[model samples]
Each structure stands twice: as structure tokens, then as C-alpha cells.
Target chain A: AQSVAQPEDQVNVAEGNPLTVKCTYSVSGNPYLFWYVQYPNRGLQFLLKYITGDNLVKGSYGFEAEFNKSQTSFHLKKPSALVSDSALYFCAVGAFGNEKLTFGTGTRLTIIP
Target chain B: NAGVTQTPKFRILKIGQSMTLQCTQDMNHNYMYWYRQDPGMGLKLIYYSVGAGITDKGEVPNGYNVSRSTTEDFPLRLELAAPSQTSVYFCASSYSLGGSGNTIYFGEGSWLTVV
Candidate 1:
């Protein structure tokens, strides 16, 4: 079964500092990974995804992710963290050709002012 | 496009009472999914439809039912509401991934509480 694991239950970072949310995955074949952010009482918003080629994938709100095939990891990163960037983050993995997505437990990111 | 839209932003139901959560999308997406988000937990798939008239069970389908009567409408029904059923429900849609997979668009969500 395809699954994703987010090691951190929560990540705390100061405003303007770089932020990283670690995600690892296990799948039978090449994985299609995605990161989603959920604000309080709202639905998840897509942050970024790793499909193929280009190890570095850029996404919304200055967020980016690096697909490390050697490590089977796709970690979300931002050059500078904003207080507004604090939210619940989820990592999901789907098979290269399958539509079914398996998601991680989620990590709460807190950006301190 | 309006993407996916969910009705009844919030609802509180008594035990045994049943209600349906309505979802619609204008994206002409071929795939639609229903998911429930619980506190501190990742979203759980309740049911999904590949297209109009084709529906299937997902990870958590018990105590819930879904129908896709039109290509644009997919409504989820909760039978005999229970406190355990209280959670925020989300509707999402995506194009047929074919072999590459596609990004899904989600609605704001519908909050339901069974007391």
C-alpha cells in the first residue's frame, strides 16, 4: 500500500526564518507526491507537488519542495516563513498512474512573530 | 470556474436524524470524492465517484451513503446520525489522471455535528 509519513507533529519557526516540513513515502512504483495546507476551519489548499523530472518544484505562496528520490522524501520548504504561513500541513502520496491518494497524519507548523 | 461547492456550511443533527451533504462542481471533472476531516487526523475518504452514475466505497464508507445522479452533483447521505459522525466534510474533484494523475480542487467544506 502507498503511504506517507510526516515525522514531525509540529514545527516551530520564527518569522522570516526558513521553514521545512519533512515528508517521506513508501510506494510500489514511482510516486506522485503533494503537499496541502489547511487553515483553521477551512479546506486544504494545494501547496506543491512532485511528479517527475526537476528535483525542485516550486508552488504557491513562495513554497517549494525537493523530490529526493534517493531518500524517498519530499520536504516542503520556504526561504522565509511568514506568520500567515502557519497552518496544518499534510503530505500525500499516490501511485504514478493511480488516482487514489494516501495521506499522512499531518504536521502543525507554527510561525512565531 | 467555481470549482467544487459544498452546501450546508454548518449543521447540527440529533441522534437518528439523517441529512444529506450536497456537492457540485462546474469544472466538468470526471472524478469526485467525499472526505471527512476529524480533529488532529488526516482526511478520510468516505466515498468517491468516477463519473455520473458510477460510485464506489472508499476507506470509510460505513454509516454513510452517496449518490451521483448527475455529472455535476454528488450528494453524501448520513444515515442515523451519531456523535461519531460529527466532522467537517469536504468535496473535491479532478480530471481523469489517465496515467499521470491530476491535482484535486477542494471546496471550502461543510461542518456537521451530530449531538
Candidate 2:
């Protein structure tokens, strides 16, 4: 079974500063990793995904993540944080030949102004 | 394209009541999923269907059941409501390219309260 781990329950960062949300995964084979953001009373919105390619993957809203194979980590990062970016984030991992995606508990990001 | 549509945006059920959450997709995708999100918790999959008449249990399927009678509709049934079942439910669908890299689209979400 594929599983994902989000180490932080909540992260606080000042607006205009850099921010990071950590994520790690355990899978049998090559992993297909994804990040999603959810706002209040809304469904999740896909941010980015890492299939197989370059270690660094850029996503929506000036966000990006680095797929570190050795570390089994895919941490979401943004150079500058915005108040509007404060929301709940999730990390998910899936393996080849499986339609199931295992998700992490989640992390709440708060951008302090 | 309307993408994925789920009905009953909000519902309240008494204990022992039964209800079904309807979901439909207009994208012609072959895969659909049902998930529930609790307060401050990650979404937990209840059931998934890869195609018509094919469904499988997911991480949290004990209190829920699902059926896929057609390619576009997958309705989730809760036979008996419990207070613990109160949460926001989301319906999602995706197209599998015979691989693991397809993107999944989600609906706005249906809020349910079991009292």
C-alpha cells in the first residue's frame, strides 16, 4: 500500500516570506505524487504532480515542489507567501497500475500579514 | 463543461436514516471516486469505480456503499446515519490513460450532518 506523510499539522509564515510544507511518501515502485489545496467550504484544487522526470516541478500560483527520490520527500515551496495562499494542503501518493491514491493527514498553512 | 456534479449540496439526516449522495460527470471519464473530508482532516476515500458496474472499497467504506450503474453516474449510499458520519463529501472523476499520471477533477462538495 502506498502512503504519504505530512509532518506538520500547521505552518505559520509571514506574508512575502518564503514558505514550505513538507511531505514524504512510501510506495512500492516509482511514485506518482500530487499536491492539492483546499479552501473553506470548497473541494480540493490540484497544485502540482510529480510523475517521473526532473526533480524540480513547478505548479500553480508560483508554487513548486522538489521530488527527492533518495529522501522519499516532495516538499511544497513558494518563494513568496501571500495571505490568499493560507489554506489546507494535502499530499498524495499513487503507484503504477493502481487507481488508488493514498493521502496524508494534511497541513494548515497560515500566512501572517 | 460542468465537470463533476454532486447533488444535495447540504443534507441533514436523523439517526438510522438512509440517504444517497448522487454524483455525475460530464467529462466522459472512466474513473470516479467518493471521498469524505472531516474538519481539519485529509479526505478519506469511501469507494471508487473504474467503469460502469464496477466498484471497489476504499480507505473508509464501512459505513457507506456505492453503485455505478452507468459510465457517468456513481451514487453513494449510506444505509444508517451516525453522528460520526457528519462531514463534507466530495465527488471526483478522472480519465486513466492506462497509467498512473491522469489528473482528477473534483466537485464543489456536499455537506452532510447526521444527528
Candidate 3:
């Protein structure tokens, strides 16, 4: 059984400051991690994914995530936050040969101006 | 490019009333999925299909049914609408399973409110 956990329900950061949303996973085999963002009344948009690659993965909207195998974590990061960056972030995990993805509870990010 | 399109962007249903949420993808992807999102809870896969005529239940399939009669369309049917069923429904598609090219594309979502 594969699962994902987002330890924070909400994260607040000041605009222009670096923002980090934490995510961790548990899987029996090598994991395929992903990050998605959802805006108000919209579906989730893919941010980035880490299947087998460098430890750091960059994604859309100036966002990036670090895939730390030892820590079993894939935390999303942005060098500078914007007020419009406020949205819901989700972390998902899937393994090879699995067609489905298991997602975390989701973390709401709010960028204060 | 209307990647993934879902009908009935917003809907209101009474208890025991049934409805079908329509989904279609122009990407010609082989895998399609249906998910429900609730407050604070991430997307939960309700059903998925590898191709036409093949469908499988996901983590949460209770009170919901789905069919994949065509490669481009995957419709989710709600048999008996309940207050618990009041949530936003999303339709997604992927080119492959888990890999570098297997990024899933999602629809704008269908907001269903069961009274």
C-alpha cells in the first residue's frame, strides 16, 4: 500500500519570501512523486514530478521540489512568493506498474502581501 | 486544445436523484480517471479506465459507477445522490502509467451539490 502525507494544513508566507510546502510518502517500491496546484473553482494543474532524476526538480510557475529519498520527502519550494500564489497544493505518490496515484490530504498556501 | 472537458460545470441534485457527469479528452490518452475532492482532503480516485470497455474502481467507489465505452469519453454515474456525495468531481487522462510522460491532465471540474 502506498500513501502520501502533507503535514501542514495551511502555510503562510510573505510575498517575495521563499515558501516551502512539506510532503512525505511511503511506498514499497521506488516512488513516482508529483506536485499539483489548484486555484479557486478550478481543477488541479500539474506542477512537477520526480520519477527517476536529479534530486531537485523544477516545475511550472517558478516552483520547484526537492526529492529526498533518505527523508522520504518531496517538498515544494518557490524562490519568491507572490500574492497570487495562494492556492491548494497536493502531493501524490505512485510506484512503477501502478496506474493509479495516492494523494495526500492537501496543503493550503496563503501568500500575504 | 480543450485537453480534458467536463460537462455540467455546476449542478444541484436532490437526494435520491441520479445524474451522469460527462467527461471527454481530445488528447487520445489511453488512461482516464475520475476523482472527487473535498475540503482539506486531496483528490480521491473514484474510478479509472485503461482503455475503452475496461473500467476499475479506485479508493472510493461506493455509490458511484463509471463506464468507458469510448477512448475519448468516460462518464461517471451517481446512482443515489446523498449529502455525502456533495463534492467537486474531476476527470483526468494520462498517456501512460507511471513514468516521465505519464502526466495527468484534468478538467475544470464539476461542482455537485446534493440537497
**Residue A10, model 1, lDDT:** 96
Which residue pairs in model 1 clash with each other? Answer: none
Q: Could you tell me every candidate's TM-score relative to the true structure?
A: 0.97, 0.96, 0.97
lDDT of 3 by residue, B22-51 (tens): 999999899999999988788899999999
Cα lDDT tens digits, model 1, B1-115, are 6789999999999999999999999989899999899877788888989988999998999999999989899999999999999999999988875224588888999999999
Error of 2 at A94 (Å): 0.5
Best by TM-score: 3
Model 3, residue pairs in steric clash: none
Error of 3 at B64 (Å): 1.2
Stretches > 4 Å off in candidate 1: B98-100
> What is the lDDT, from 0 to 100, of the residue A4 in candidate 3?
95
Residues B72-97, candidate 2: write the lDDT tens digits. 99999999899999999999999983
Candidate 1 lDDT, A51-110, residue by residue in tens: 889999999999999999999999999999999999999988888767578789899999
Per residue, candidate 3 scores C-alpha lDDT tens digits across A1-113 of 88999999999999999999999999888999999899999998999999887999999999999999999999999999999999999999999888888889999999999
